[model samples]
Target chain A: GQQVQQSPASLVLQEGENAELQCNFSSTATRLQWFYQRPGGSLVSLLSNPSGTKHTGRLTSTTVTKERRGSLHISSSQITDSGTYLCAMSNNNAPRFGAGTKLSVKP
Target chain B: ETAVFQTPNYHVTQVGNEVSFNCKQTLGHDTMYWYKQDSKKLLKIMFSYNNKQLIVNETVPRRFSPQSSDKAHLNLRIKSVEPEDSAVYLCASSPDWGSQNTLYFGAGTRLSVL
Candidate 1:
C-alpha cells in the first residue's frame, strides 16, 4: 500500500527559532498540499506546492516530485504556530495524508 | 471565507448506537470526500462522492455510508458504531477530480465511542 511518512513525529522549538518538517511519499503524485491543524481547531490549507518552492507568510514549502518528498519550513516560529502539520498527496483516484508532525513552540 | 463546515464538533456515544455527521461546502465544488483520522493521526480515505455519485468506496464496511443531498452537502452515517470507530471525521471538497485542484477541509467532528 502507498503511504506518506512525516518526520520527527514531534518537534519542540523556542520562539523565534526555525523548524522544518519533512514528508515522504512512496507513490507518484502530481499535486501535494500542506495543512496546519491547531489544537482542537480546524485544518487550514497552508500551501499547495506540487513541485519546487512556495512561500506564504512565515511558512515555506519545497517539493521534489521526482524524489517523492516535500518539506515545510517555518521561519522565526511563534507560540501560535504550535500545532500539527499534515502533508497530503493526490493520486489519480484519491489523496493520501501523512500521520502529521506535531509542533510545540515555546516562549 | 470558510468553504466547508461540519456539524456536531464533538460526539460521545456507546457501541451499537447510530450516528450521523453532516458536512456542507460553499465552494461550489463538484467533488466531496470523507476521511477518518485515527488515534495515531493517520488520515485515511473512506468514501468519495463526485457530483452526488459514489466514486470511491475503499472497501468501507457496510455500517458506514455516505449520503449527499446535493453537490454542496455530503453526510456520513454510521450504524452500530464500535469503539474502533471513535476518531476524527473530516469533510473536504474540491472543484474537480483533477490533481490540479486543491481540497478545502472543514473543522472535523471528533467522535468518542465508549
Candidate 2:
C-alpha cells in the first residue's frame, strides 16, 4: 500500500516568521499536491507540483520525484494562516493524504 | 471558488442508523471521490467514481455504498453506522482518472454517531 508521511506534525510561529513542512511518500507518485484547511472548513488546493519547485503567493513547494519527498515553505506567516497543511500524492489512482501538519501563526 | 457542494454540513445519528450524504460538482469534472477524515485528521479514500461508473472501491465495509447518477453527482450511503463511523466525509472532484489534475473539495459533512 502507498503511504504519505508528513513531518513536524505541528508548528507554531510568529507573524513575521517562516514555516516549512515536509512530506515523504512510500512509493512513486505521479502527482503531488499541498492543501490548506481551516478548522471545520473545506480543503483548499495550495499547490500541485509533481516535480521541481513551484510558488504561489507566499507559499512555495519543492518536489523531488526520485527521492519521493516534497516540502512546503510559507513566508511571512499571518495569524489567519493558522490551520492544517496537508500533503497528498497519487500514482495512478485516487490520491492518498498524509496525517497533515497543524500550523499556528501567532501575533 | 467552491464549485463542489455537499449537503447537510453536520449530521447526528445513533448506532444502527442509516445516513446518506450528497455531493455535486459544478466543475464538470469526470471523476469524483469520497474520503473519510478521522478525528486525528487522517484521510483515507473510500470510493471513487469516474463518469458515473465505479472506478476505485477501497476496502471499506460492505455496509457502505456509493451511488453515482452522473459525472457531476456522487452520493454515499452508510448502513448501520457505528461509533467508529463518526468522522468527516469529504467529497472531491478531479478532471479525469489520471494524476495530472488537481482536486476540488467540498466543505465536507461531519457525522456524529453515538
Candidate 3:
C-alpha cells in the first residue's frame, strides 16, 4: 500500500546536464516534500511544494494536487548533486515516502 | 547550523540488547518525528509527537516506543534489538502539524545488530 511512487529508480547524467524526477501519489496530498539523501547520510528537505510550482537555486518542484502527482527538476546538475532524491507526501499528519530516485552526476 | 541533533552517529549491539536513541531540535518546532531508512533505501515514518503528546504511531513493533519530555526533544527506545532493526534512524521536526511547514531532519543514527 505505497501511497507515493517515484519513477526511474536510478538516474545518471553528465555534469551540467539537467534531470527530471517524478513523484506520483495514490490520493490527494495536502503537503508534498522533496528530499535529498547522500550516501550513508540523512535526508535534507529540498522543496515543500504542495501545489503549483516552486523554485530554489537550480531545483524546481511542481505539484498537481488534483492529479496527485509531483515533479522535481534539477537544472545544471553538478557532480556534488549526486545523491538519492526522495519524494514524500502527506494527506494528514504522517508523511509517506516513495522508493526514491538515485541520481549520479558524472564529471 | 545543526538544528536537529542525534547522538551516537553509529551504534553496534548484539541481539536482545536494549538500545535508545536521542533526538533534540532547536528550531522550536511543535512536532517531532522518527523515521527509519532501511538498507534498500526505503524511508518510513515510525512515530510523531507534537507538544510532547503522541500524535501519529505507525504500525511499528511494540518493542519500539517514543518518549518525549518536551516539544523540543523526542527519544526512541527499543526494548530488544533484532537483526531487522539494523538501519538508519532519522529524526525530523516541523514548525507544526500544519501543511505549511516543511520537515527538517537530523543526520541520523546508524544501528547495527548482530
Candidate 4:
C-alpha cells in the first residue's frame, strides 16, 4: 500500500504558466523529499524540505511536518518540466512513496 | 555534484536466466536504496541498505537479492529472470538514514525478460 499521497495524479499546464503539486502523507514523516523524473528517464532530486521552505531554480517546496502536507510550486512551466513529480518520505528507516504527479507542459 | 551510477541502461534476457544490475555512489553516502517502477508508473521500494543492515520489502520475490559490497555500492541479483520482473530498477543513495536526507538517483536500468 502507498503511504504517501500526491494530488492531481496528472496535470497539464500551458507554457509560462505556474503549477502547484501537493503531497500528503498518512503518517508523521521525519523527512520528506521531492523528485522529478522525465519520461523513461532518471530521477532528479528537486528538494528535501522536511518542515520548511526551500527553493532551487524555478522550483519552490514547502512542507508542514505537523500537518503532513507539502507542496511544490513551479514558476514559468516549460516543456522540460513535463514529467512525473514524485514525493517520498522517510520515518526511521522505512521510506514510502506516492504514485506521483504527471505534468505536461504545452507550448 | 554527487552522482549515482547504474549500469546496463537497458537489458533483455530470457526467462530462467540470471541477471545482475550494479549500482555505485560517489557521494560516499551511508544509505542506499533500490526501487522498482512498474509499467503503470508506480514506484515501489525494493530494498534499502544502511552500511550493514539490509531491509527488504515483503512483496519482493525470493529470486530478487540485493548485495552491497561496501558503503558505496549496492547490486541487485536476480536468480531467475521472469516476465514479471520486466520494469525499471532505480538506484539511489542518501547522505544519511534520516527522512530529510536528499536522495541522488541513477538514471535506472530497464529490464525486459522474454
Interface RMSD of each: 1.1, 0.6, 1.1, 1.6
What lDDT tens digits, residue by residue, belong to model 2 across residues B1-114? 789999989999999999999999999899999999999999999999999999899999998999999999999999889999999999999999987869999999999999
> In model 4, what lDDT does residue A48 have?
84
Q: On a 0 to 1 TM-score scale, where does candidate 4 land against the true structure?
A: 0.94
lDDT of 4 by residue, A1-107 (tens): 43899999999999999999999998888888888888887888788877899999999999998998999999999988899999988777656778999999999
The docking category that best describes candidate 1 is medium
Q: What is the interface RMSD of candidate 4, in Å?
A: 1.6
Q: Which ten residues in a row have the lowest lDDT in candidate 4 chain B?
A: B50-59
Flag the better candidate by lDDT, 3 or 4.
3
Task: Please state the error at residue A65 of candidate 4 in Å.
Answer: 1.7
Candidate 1 vs 3: which has more lDDT: 3
**What CA RMSD would you report for each candidate?**
1.2, 0.7, 1.0, 1.6
Which residue pairs show backbone clashes in model 1? none
What TM-scores does chain A show, candidate by candidate in order? 0.96, 0.98, 0.97, 0.95
Number of the top TM-score candidate = 2
lDDT of 1 by residue, B4-70 (tens): 9999899999999999999999988999999998878788999889899999888778999999989
Give the per-residue lDDT of model 3 (tens digit) for B3-114: 9999889999999999999999999999999999999899899999989999899999999999999999999999999999999999999999867658899999999999
**How high is the lDDT of residue B37 in model 2?**
98
Give TM-score, chain B, model 1.
0.97
lDDT of 3 at A99: 95
Best by DockQ: 2
